[model samples]
Target: MATSWNGLSSVLPEESYMTLITALAFTVLWLLWSISSYFRCRNRLPLPPGNFGFPVIGQTVEHLLALRTADGIRQWMQKQVDKHGPVFRYRFVGYPMVMMSQPEGNKFIFQNEGLSNHIFWPSHISTMFGPHAVITQSGERHKLVRCHLNRFFDRAAMGRYIHGVNCNAIRHFTNHWQGKEQLVALDIINFFTGSCVCNLALSLEEGPLMYRILEETQTWIGGLYCLPINLPGFRYYKALKARGSIFKLLDGLMEQRRQMIAEDHVPEALQNDILNSLLTVPDEEGNLRQDSFIKDNLLILLFGGYDTSSVTLAMTIFYIAKNPHVYEQILQEQKLIVDGKCSSGENENALTMEDISAMKYTWGAIQETLRLHPVLTGSYRKTVTDLEYEGYHIPKGWLLNWNSQHSHYNPKYFKDPFKFDPSRWEKRPPPFTYLPFGGGVHLCLGYEFARMEMLIFIHHLVRNFSWSLVDPSYDGPIIRDPLPRTKDRVLINVKRVIAS
Candidate 1:
C-alpha cells in the first residue's frame, strides 16, 4: 500500500507546484488587463495624434537626462514633431508627455483655452518650492496675487527704480574694472546685473540673505527637474535638503516681515513691493493665511527676475561684441533718442515711458537673445481630466510637454531661426510664438519688472564699456542645469571705448 501511494504521489503534480502556476497565470492576466485598460481608457480622450510610448518610464530619458545642453532639447523635439506630426506623445521616465508643436496646438495651450495656467511641475517641485510659490498656484488665486503685483509693473513704479538701477550699474562697473582688461568684462557685467536685480527688488540691506536664498532656490529648481529617484547622497537628495533649508529660511523671514507689518513699520505705500503686497492682500476666502506664501513666492520672483535678465544681458553683450555692426546700429538708435531726434522728447535727465519706448531696437535685441537661448527648454502640464484630440485620447494624469523651444528654433516657423537676428522680432511673430515671459493667466508677474530692469541695466552698461570675449570660441556646451549656464563663466575683456 505504501509503495503504491509513493508511486502515485511521484506521478501527480505537487500542490505547491499547482499553486505557483496559478499565481503566475493570475499575474500575467492582471498585467494584460492593466495594459488593455490603459489602452482602452487612453484612447477615449480627444487628444492630438501621437504614440503612447512605453509603460511607466516614458520619453523622460531623452527629454531630461539625455539632453543636458541648451540646444539638445530643441533638436530632440524637432525630430519628434517631424515623425509624429505637430502633436505627439513622449514618455519621460514613467510619465507620459503629450508634445504639441503646431500653431493650432500652441494656440490651444497658450492663448485660447488658457492651458498655460496649468502647473505641471513634478511632485518633488512642490517639495522644494513650497505650495505657496507662484508655480504651484492656479486659477483665481493666481489672479489675486497677479493683480496685487501689477502695481509694481506700472510705468510709474519702473520710473522710481531707474535711478537706483543705473546707480548700481555704474558703481559696480567703475569699482570692479579699475584696471581690468577687456577680457574680464563679461564676468563683471554678470556680477553687476546680479547685484542690480538684487538691489532693485529687495533693498540692498537684504542683499546677502536674498543671494543665499536665490542660490539655494536655483539648486532646488535644478534638482526638481531631475529624476525623482531618492538614492542616498544623490543630486536629487541634496536638492531636497537644500529646499528644506530654503523654506526654513523663508519661514523665518516671513515671521520677521509679519512682525514688522504688525508694528506698522511697513507702510501701505510700500506694500506695492513684492513682500508687503502679498502680506497685506488676503486670499479669495478672506482668510489671513500663513506668511510662507509671500516669502517663498518672493523668493521665486527673485530667482526668475535676476537669472533670466542676466542671461539675456550676457547674450546681448556677446552679440554686440561679436557683431559690431549691430552694436553701432543700437548705439545710433540711442544717439537719436539722446540727441532729441526721436519722437520721445525726453533725454538722459529722466527716462520716461516715451523715452524707453523709443529704443525699439534695444528691446528687439532682448527678444532675439531669448529666441536663441530660452531659459526654459519646454513647458510641462499634467492632465486633470480626460481630453480628446483628433480621434485619439489623452488620459487624465498624463503630462503634456509644450515643446516651445522646438517651435522657436524651427526654420519653418522662423526664417533662419539659428541666426541671432533681433530684426526678426522687428516684425512680431505669431501670438504664442515668442513666449519667453510665458502666457496665459500664469504669465510671469515679474515680466514687466524684468524687462524694465534689463532695458535700464543694458542701456547703462553698453554706454560705458566696450566688451569682447577673452576667447571667442568659449561658446562650447552650455549646461542647462540651472538656467543655461555655460561650461565656463563667459569671460569678456572690457575697456572704456576711446573713440578715434
Candidate 2:
C-alpha cells in the first residue's frame, strides 16, 4: 500500500511527525550551510590548482603504482611539478594535500611545527599505537614523551649495544649466509635486523616468543597501507588484531622486566636493551614513565630498529655489489679499521663506539644510499592555522606533505642530482636539502642508533664477504612495503672472504 506523506504523518503521533520534520529540516539546512561555506571559501581563497581525479580513492592507485620502482616517485612527482609547478594540490587516498618541495617550505613547516602545523598521523595509526603513543602526541605531551625517549639514544646507551650489533651480524652470517651462494639479500637482512631488535632492544633471546613477536610485527606493519575500516576481511582489522596480540604478549614481557627491576637482578649484557632501561630508571623528573608508554614504545623501538636499518643496510650492500669502484673504496676503508684493531691487539673483530665513529667513508656510503633510496620519501603534517605558502591558501585540516626528492634530486642543492656519489656527503648539504632521516625536531629520534647499527653491519659485511647483484644492470623498480624497497628480490651471489 502506497501511503501519502499526510497518511504517514497520521500513522505517527503529531508530536513525533513534527520532530521528524524538524530533524530533516535541520539536516538540509546544515548541508546548505556547509556547501555555501565551501563555495564562499572557494570564491575568497583559491586552492592550489591540480587535478585529484575522483573522490575518496583519488590518485592513490596511481601514486602507489608509481612508487613501485626506483626513481619512479621522483619522476611521478616531477610530472606534477612540470605541469603544476612545485607547490600544488593532490589527493592521496582521499586526503587533500599540498606538496611543499622547497627548503623554505620545509623550514616553515618544521619551524612552525607546534605553532602553525603539527604532526599528522591518521586515526588508524593513532588507534594502533594507542592515544598515548609518541607518534600520536603533539606540543607538551610530545615533549614529555620525547624527553623520556632521549635516554635510549644517548652515547652511553649506544655504547652498551655496540658489541651486540657486531655479535648479531656474526651470528647471522654464520647461521644463515655461510653456505648459501645465491639468496635474496633483503630477506637475510630483515631476519638479521629482527634478531638484533629482539635480542638487543626487547631482551628476547632466540626462542619461540621472539619469533612470534617478529611474525606479529609483519601483520601489524601490513595495516599501515590499509584503510582504517574495522570490518571482517580487512587488513586494518587484521592489523588491529595483530596489534592487540602483540600488546598482550608485550604485557607479559613488561611484567618480566618489572620483576627483574624489582629484584635488581638485570645482567650487565641485558642492561643495554631499551626496555630494561626504560622500566627501571626514572625520567629527568625522577618519575618512572607510564606503563602504557613503555609498552607502546617497545613496539616503536622494535619496529623502528628493523624498518629503518634493514632496507638502507640492504641497499648499501646492493649499491656496493653493483658499483665495483664504490665497493673498492668501501672495502679499502673497512680494511684499514680492521687492520688498526689487529695491530693494537684489541679483540681483532670487535666493534666499538670509536670504531663506528671512524667509519667515515662507509657511513658516507650509507648516507648516499639513504639519499637515493629513502625508506619514506616524505611525511605528512597538518596545519593548525590557515596560512599562506608560496602564494597558496593552505586551509587548516588539509594535509601538508614535504618530499625529500625535491631537494635530494634538485640540481640547485646537489651538483649532479640523481648520481650516486658518496663523496657528496663528505660535506653536509645545505639546510633542508638532504633529509634522509628527516630534519628538525621530528628528525628521526632513531637517527644516531640507525647510523651506528648500519655502520656496524657494513663493517662486518665489507670485511667478511664479497657479493654481486643477480641483475647487475637493474637500477630498481622500488616497491613499497609501506616504504620504498627494491621490487626485485634484490637477488645476489655472496661468498665468505678472509676472517679477521
Candidate 3:
C-alpha cells in the first residue's frame, strides 16, 4: 500500500537516518551497560532479592521511605513473603535484593560466625556518628569494644549505680516540676529519661545547654529516620548539623570527664560510667584506646540508649493514660508491692529484681507499645560476602534490611497483632517475634539499662500523679517519625494522686 517514497519514509523512516540514529543509541547504551556491568561484576555476590532502581542510587531512597511507617512497608513485604515464601528477591530502589524472613532464616543469618558484620547506614549517618563507633566497627575491634561496653550495662554494674540513678531521676523530676504552673509531663518524662541515660554515659547532670542540645539532636535524628537524603537545605541536612553540634557538646563533656578522671577528682561511685568504662578497659596488649575511640563509642551509647528508651516510655505513657483501666491496674500492682502483696509478694515502690520480674503486666504493656510502635521500624545491614538462606541467594555488596514492624505484626506470629494488648508478651511471644530492641549479635547493648530506666520512671510517675488527655482533639493513634509523639503531642491534664 505504501509504494511511494513519501509513504515509505513515513512508515519505516529513511534507512540512512535510521542507521545513524540506531548506531548512536547503540553506542550510548553500550557505554551505560559497560559501566553498570563493571559495578555489578565487581560486587559479584548473589544479593538478596530487592528492587533495583536506577543504577547509581540503586534502591536506597525507595527502601528508606517505604520503611518510614510502622507497618506499611512490612505489610508489603508480608504480601511478597506470602507469595514467594520465606525467601524472595524484590526490586528495591532499582537493585535486586534477596531477603530471608523465616525465624530459621533469622537464626541462620544471626548465628553464622562468618557472615560479614558491616552496617548499612547512609554515608551521612556514618560521617556524623564517626567511623570507629562500636556499632560500625568490625572483627576484633568491635568485639573488644562490645565486651567492655557490656560490663557497664550488666546487672552488677547497674546495681552499683542505683543510687546515682535514683538521684538523677529525682533531680530531673524536681527540676521540671518545681515551679511550672502547667508542666508538660511528657517532655519532662523525655528529659528525665535523657538525663538518666546521660548520667549513665558521661555522668553529667542535664542542664540548660544539655537540654537544648538534646532537643535539637532529637529533631535531627528523628528527621534522618524519614528523610534519608542529604540534599542541601533538606531536613536531614539540618538534622545532620544539629547532630554535629550535639557531638561537639558531647566532646566537651567527654573531655571534662577525661580530665577529671586524670586528676582523680571524679566521684568514686560514678567514675565508671560508659566513658570511663571504655577509658579504663585495657586490651590484651595492655594498651588503652585513644580518646577518639572513647568519645565515639560514648556517643553511640548516648544516642542509641537514650533516644529509643525515651520514645518507648513516652508511647507507653500514651497507652496507659488512654486506657485508664491499664493505668489503674499498674497502680494496683504497684500498691500490692507497697502493701507487700505483690504477685510473688514484694514491697511496693521498692522493686527488687524479683518485683520488676513479677510486674509481668507492666512489661507486657511495654511490649505492646513496642510492637505497635517500634522506636525503630527497621535495621539495615550490608553483606561482606555472598550468602544464601531459605533458598534465596543473598549477594555481597548489597544493602539488606530487617523490617521490624512487618515481623512484629505478622498474624502468623502474634494474635490480633495490631491491637495494644500487653498480655501477649506476658506469655512471651516466640523469639524474634517482637523485636523492639532488634535481635542477633547486634541486639541493643543498652537493653537492660533501658528497661530499668523505664521501670523507674513509670513507677515514680504512676505513683505521683493521675493524667489524661487535656485536649479533646488529641484523641487518636500516635503519629510517627519526625518526632513520634501523640497526634496533639500527648497533651495530658495532670493531678497529683494522694497517697493513702
lDDT by residue for model 2 (1-500), tens: 89999889879999999999999999999999999999987776667889778887788778766765657778888999899988889888678888887888788888888998888876667777777767777888888788778767778878877777788888888888888898888877887788877886677766789888988887888777656789979988998899889989988988887788789887776776778777877866898878787778878777687866888888888878777898888888888888898889988678888888888888888888888888778788888788887777888888888888878888898888777788887898899888877765677777777888888778777777889988888875666666656667578988889865
Candidate 1, residue 85: lDDT: 73
List model 1 lDDT by residue over 461-489, tens digit each: 56665767777766657666656655555
What are the clash counts of all predictions, listed in order? Answer: 22, 3, 33
Which residue runs does candidate 1 get wrong by more than 4 Å?
1-54, 111-117, 154-156, 182-190, 229-232, 267-272, 341-349, 498-500
**What TM-score does model 1 achieve against the real structure?**
0.82
User: Per-prediction TM-score, please?
Assistant: 0.82, 0.85, 0.81
**Greater-TM-score candidate between 1 and 2:** 2
Model 2 poorest ten-residue lDDT run: 476-485
Q: Which lDDT tens digits does candidate 3 get at residues 1-500? A: 53875655677757876886799999999999999999977766443443455775655565566555444456667777777665666555444555656556555555653366355666666766778787876667778778877887888876766566656665665666544445454566778777877777766677887687678767666665554567777777777777677778867866777788789898875666676766766766899877677766766776776677777877787788768889988887666655664454543434456556666787778878888888766556677877655544566676555656656777888888767777676576677666777777677888887877777677667777777766644545455663356655556666776643
What are the C-alpha RMSDs, in order, of all predicted structures? 7.3, 6.8, 9.3
For model 3, the local distance difference test gives 0.68
Which regions of candidate 3 are displaced past 4 Å? 1-50, 78-86, 90-96, 116-118, 177-185, 226-232, 341-351, 471-477
